[model samples]
Target: MEFRQVSDLNFNISRVTLGTWAIGGWMWGGSDDQLAVGTVIEALEKGITTIDTAPVYGFGKSEKLVGQALQEFGNRDEIQLATKFGLEWDDEGNVQRNSTRERILKEVDDSLRRLQTDYIDIYQVHWPDLDTDFSETAETLQELLDSGKIRAIGVSNFSPEQMDEFQQTAPIHVCQPPYNLFERGIEKDVIPYCKENGITLLTYGALCRGLLSGKMSKDRTFNKGDMRRDADPKFQGETFDKHLEAVEKLKEYADKNFDKKVIHLAVRWILDKGIDSAIWGARKPEQVTFDNAFGWKFSHKQVKGVEEIVETIVEDPVSPAFMAPPE
Candidate 1:
């Protein structure tokens, strides 16, 4: 339940943000609306105030569910709402990036309607559209800010170069990227650039899409719709086995240093890396319980130890090459 300022924006958010992609059920498996609603309620009760969602997720189904859950809880002002646009989901369930000025304007209106909110606390471009001019997208974001439809605008899955290009035209308050013990790509440039520019680093995949949990076995199989089953490189064949081996080592460190679970150690490790917030994509209440066990305090030695273990196992310098294209 520890809180931190989301950059210098004068607003405080919980260290753990509730990620709504699981609730979207677009690429993940076994998502129940009631279960997702219960998880959201439980997260708010447990002091998690920030909820992250995207319009492309389930082609707006996720935002609708989030709106219903918020209305059911009746605590809109108590929570910090964040969602993204720019990724379009066509009739065939294909995802495409569209950051054109016209598309951005229409998407913001659509998102606000689905979210049941007039203004979003944090509105981000889900990915960079290289085909469109960065300045064009920035201008549209500025218009949204001026119109009060969005309080702040940020970018997600953007490289250091893209961030700089967009920031030159508009103010950015946050940066959301995949950053975890298994994915330290942000350490190269994105994180340092955010620090230098006073942008908050809101990290997702803090569990490496559940790789660091030490639960999935080598023979584990995912449902056909489970996107990571086919999309994640680490989840395929020998890479999956190697990933589990690394998690075993992390478990040893967790056992020796503290009584927390491996997942808690994983989360604490990310927070210790100077990240502004860690987004948790917990579908069940039990998952939340595991994440809540570790809070704001970790010894410097322990932090260093976790880093060393990850580096030793992965043996790859964190790089932006793993980032998916805007689509």
Candidate 2:
């Protein structure tokens, strides 16, 4: 129910954005179209009007489903649509980072058509394409900004140096990065950099691929398409058990201190760190509930306790870099 402004945009987006990566049904096994559409409506009705998706998500299925949901909702002016470009796919479903001017130009129209919107609230580059010039991509996005097709520009998985180069040609109103209890790499630099520059941070993977959802069991199995089955090392060997133990202790900590669950604790921790928003991913409508994460504050001592829980248990923690596609 909380909202935050991106500073550059004219409107405010919900503090919790609905992430449709799973709904796209490309990586996290397949999803039900009916369930996917219902998820969007469920989020909106729950006060989550900011929906974040990408073209490479199901190669466009996510956006199309979002478009269908928007039409069903019947109020385009009230919702903030955040999507991305700079990624292309093949018939076999391989994706490559391609921020070339031509790629973005063509992709923007496709995104508009799929989302059934004339202008995107926040348009971001999915990944940094080292083959392309930062200015080239920046100028192209600036052109879209000038044309009223995109209200704000953002970059994801970008280092501070990459962002420095990107801002030379255009302003970055937002920055999307992988951040959560398990992935704290951004805290070393990205968080501080965005804070100093007045850029809004919309962090993704808040649940760390369902690891922190407090619903995973030791014998749980993943589908062939699930990234956790192979791409993520945290899901393999002792590392998985270490994280699961940490999640268990976190659950206990949440219930003891706040009468909440580990998932709420995970979200409130991110928001308390001053991040503008956290991208909560879910393909099912009932999975979108997060009211417990709000209306409470984490004390410094409580935060230290959660940190101790993670640090003490997950000695061999892994980064989320394994999920990144080949550039």
User: Which candidate number maximizes TM-score?
Assistant: 2
Tens digits of lDDT, candidate 2, 80-111: 99999999989999888899999999999999
Query: Could you tell me how far off, in angstroms, the CA of residue 276 lies in candidate 1 after the best superposition?
Result: 0.6
- lDDT minimum window of 10 residues, candidate 1: 317-326
lDDT tens per residue, model 1, 57-173? 778888888888888887787788999988876688877788999998898888888888888989999988988999999999998888888878889998888988998899889
Q: How far is candidate 1 from the true structure (C-alpha RMSD, Å)?
A: 1.9
User: Judged by lDDT against the true structure, how good is candidate 1?
Assistant: 0.82
Residue runs of model 2 more than 4 Å from their true location after superposition: none
Q: Which residue runs of candidate 1 sit more than 4 Å off their true CA positions?
A: 290-296, 316-327
Q: What residue pairs are clashing in model 1?
A: none
Question: All candidates' TM-scores?
Answer: 0.94, 0.99
